[model samples]
Target: MEWGRCSEKELKDLEAIVGAENLSTGESALGLVSRDESYYTPKIPPQVVVMPASAEEISAILKIANPRRIPVTARGAGTSIEGNPVPLFGGIVVDMQRFDSIIEIRPEDFITVVEAGVGYKDLNKALGRHGLFFPPDPGAAATIGGMIGNNASGVRTIKYGATKDYVLRMTVVLANGKIMEIGSLATKSSSGYDLARLFVGSEGTLGIVTQATLRLAGIPAHHSAAVATFPTLQAAAQAVFDIMRWGFSPTALEVLTADLVQMLNRDRGLGLREEHTLFLEFQGASEIALEEELGAVQDLCQEAGALSFQPGLGIDERNKLWEARYETYESIKHTHPGADPFVADVAVPISRYPEILEYTAEIIRDHGVTGYPFGHAGDGNLHVVFMGDASDEEEWGRIVRANEAIVSRALELGGTCTGEHGVGIGKQPFMEREHGASLGLMREIKSLLDPQGILNPGKVFP
Candidate 1:
C-alpha cells in the first residue's frame, strides 16, 4: 500500500481528533514505527501515526480506516520480541501510548482496570502502595494491552499464571468500528464463549484492546530467594520436575544453563558460574512456611545432583541476579558483537524438558551456532537464543538450522512453539507445522472478525 494513495481529508480529520502535534508523518517518527524488536527489519512504514486517547476515539479512527480499506496496526509499547507492532503493510499505526491511565484500583476486590498504554513497571509501582501485585512480568516494561495481546508471562508466572489468567475483562474496538465488551470483573464465569481469551493472544489481528480489568493478588507476608547448582542442565531440569512432583510450588523456578551463567559472568562480572543452576524464589504467609519451602526445594535439588545450594544475596543482590536473566538479549549481543540474538521461545512438557535441552545441545554442536538456554522451568518454557556473527553466512545458516531443529524437537515432544510470546510474523511460518488444520480455523476467525484484513495484516498466518 502506498502512503500517497491515502485520503488527505481523512488524515486532516484524524489530526484534528488527536492534536496536530500528536499526529506525525515525519521521517523520524515513521522510522520508529517501521520496525519492532524483531530480528529482521522491514522497510515498511505507516501512512500516518495516530495516538488516540480513548476507546471512542479509536472507534472513530477505525471507522475511517475500515471505510477506506486502510490497514490499522494497533501498537502499545512496541517491546514485542516478535515484531508484533511493525506496520508490515503501510497504513495507520494507532499508537496507544496516550491512553495510559489507571482507570480504577479496587484493593478490596483485588482487581484493577487500566488503559492499554499503562506500562508494567508503572502499574507495579502504583499497586505496590496497596500491598498487591499483577504478576505477569514479561521482562520489559511492556504495555498492559500488548501483554494481553501476546498472552505474555514470565518467571513470576509459575505461581500466578499468565496474562490471560489474570485478565478479567477487556473493552475492544473492532475493525468495523463496533465496540464490544468481553468477560467481566467477577472472579469466575461460566457464561459463554470466553471471547476475551480469544483476543488475549490475537496479536491485534482481530480487534484492538482498549482497556483491561486485571486480577491482582495480595503481597505475600514473607519472600526468600535461593540459587542451586547442578552437575548438568538435565539435573537442573530434573530438580524442577521433582519440586512439582512433591506438590510444593515456588513463586519462581528458573533454569539457567552453564553457557548462560558464563555469559552473565563475562558480561556483567558478577561471578555467577555453575554448570546448571536453579534460581528459585519463594513467597508464603509466614517466614516459617517460606523456610520450609526453601528446605524442601534444596533437598530436591540435592537429589538431582546439586553440587551446592547457595542462599541468594540480599534484596539488592537478588535483584542483580535476576537482572542478568532479563537482559539476556543485551548480554548475548555484547559477547558476540555483530551477532543477531534471534530468540526461539518454545515450551516442552515437564517430563520432556530434559530431552528438549539435550536435543538443543546437539543442534548447537552439530551446527556450530552459539545457543543460550534459560527460562521459566516451572512453566516448562525455555528461551533458546541463537547467535552468530552477522557477516558470516556459514554461521547464519547454522543459526537457521539450529532454530529449525529446536522448534521441530519442541513440537515432537508435545510442546508449543511459544509459551508466552504470540505467533507474530517470526513464528507465523510454523503455524501449519504446529496447528495443522486448526490454522485454517484461526484464519476463519480472523476473517469473521476482520473481513478487510485491515487489523494487523501479514501476521499470525503465513
Candidate 2:
C-alpha cells in the first residue's frame, strides 16, 4: 500500500491536541520511534510522534486521526521482535511511556489496575510490598499493557500460564475513537462477547490498550532452583518432557544448548559447559514442598540419562543465573561480531520438539553459519537467531534459505511462525502458509475493527 503524505492541517491539528512540545517531526526522533527491535529495516519515518498523557487524550487523538486517515501505531518499550512498531505507511507514533502509573492494587481480589506503560520490574516491585506478584514476565521489561496486547508468556509460563490467562479487565481505546471496557474484575464471567481476548493479542491492530486489571499471585514463602546438565541437546529436551510428565511443576523451566551454555560460561563465568542445561525454579510455602519438587525433578533427570543434576544456586546465585536468560539478544549478537541477527520465535508440540530442533540445526549447519538455539523448552518455543553476514552476499542468501527451511519444518509439525512475538511485518509473508484460509478471516476481522486501515496498517494479515 502506498503511503500518503501527512497533510499540514493534520500535523497542526495533532500538534494542537498533544501540544507542541509533545509532537515532533524531526527526522532523528521519528526514525527512533518508527521501528523497534525487529529485523525489518527502517523505512519512511513517522510523520510525527504524539505523547498523550492520559487515556482521554489518546481517545481524542484517535478521534482526530481516524477521520484524517492517519496511521497510529502504539509503542511500548520498543522490544517487539516482529516489527510491530515499524510504520510501513508514514503515520503518527503514539509514545505510551508517559502513561506509566500503577493505579491501584486489590490484594483481596488478587488484581492490579495499571496503565499501559507500567514496566514489569516496577509492577513486581510494587506488588512485592503486598505479598503478591505478577507472573507474566516477558523479557525486556515489557509493559503490562503490552504484555496483554501480545499475550506474552515468559519462562515461568510452564506453570503460571500466559498473559491472556491473568487479564481480568481492560480499558481499550478502539480504532474508531471509542473507549470500550471489556471483561470484569470477577474471576469468572459469561460476558456477552469475549472482547478482552480479542484485544489481548491483537498487537494494536484492533485497538490501543490504555489500561488493564491483571491477576496477581501470592508470593511463595519457599523456592528452589536447579541447573541440570545433559551430555547432548536431545537429552536436555528429553529431560524437560520427562520431568513434566512426572507431575512436577516448576515456576520456570528453561533449556539451554551447549553453545549457549558456553557463551554464558565465557561471558558470565557460569562454568556451564560439556552439558546441555535445564534451569528449573520451584516455588512453595515450605521447605518440604520445595525439596520434594526438586527431589522428583532430580530423579526424573536421572531417568532421562542426564549427565548430572544438582540443586540451583542460592537466592543471589539464582538471580544472577536468570539474568543471563534476559540478555539472550545481546549474547547472540556478541556470538558473531560484526554480524546483524534477526531472531525468529517458533513453537511446536513437545513430542515434536527434538525433531524440529534437529531440522533447525541441520539447516544452520548446511549454511555454514552460526546461530543460537534457545527458548522456553517446557512450552516448546524455540528462538532461532539468523545472523546476517555483511561481507558475503552468498552467505546472506544461505541464511535466508536456512530461515525458510526452519520455518517450513515448524509449520509441518503443527507449529506456528510465531509463538509469543506478534507477526509484525517480519512474518506477514508467511501468514498464508501458516494459516491458509484463516488469513482471510483475520483480514476480515481487521477490516471490521479498522475499516479505514488506519490502525497499524500493513501488519499481521500482510
The number of the candidate with the highest lDDT is 1
Please report, as a residue range, the 10-residue window in candidate 2 with the lowest summed lDDT: 36-45
lDDT tens string, model 1, 12-52? 98898888988998888888877777765545567888899
For each candidate in the order shown, give its overall lDDT on alpha carbons.
Answer: 0.85, 0.83
Pairs that collide, model 1: none
lDDT of 2 by residue, 205-228 (tens): 899988999899999998788899
Model 1, position 317: C-alpha lDDT score:
72
Clashing pairs in 2: 225-312, 226-312
Backbone clash numbers for all candidates listed: 0, 2
Ten contiguous residues with the weakest lDDT in model 1: 1-10
Cα deviation in Å at residue 405, candidate 1?
1.0
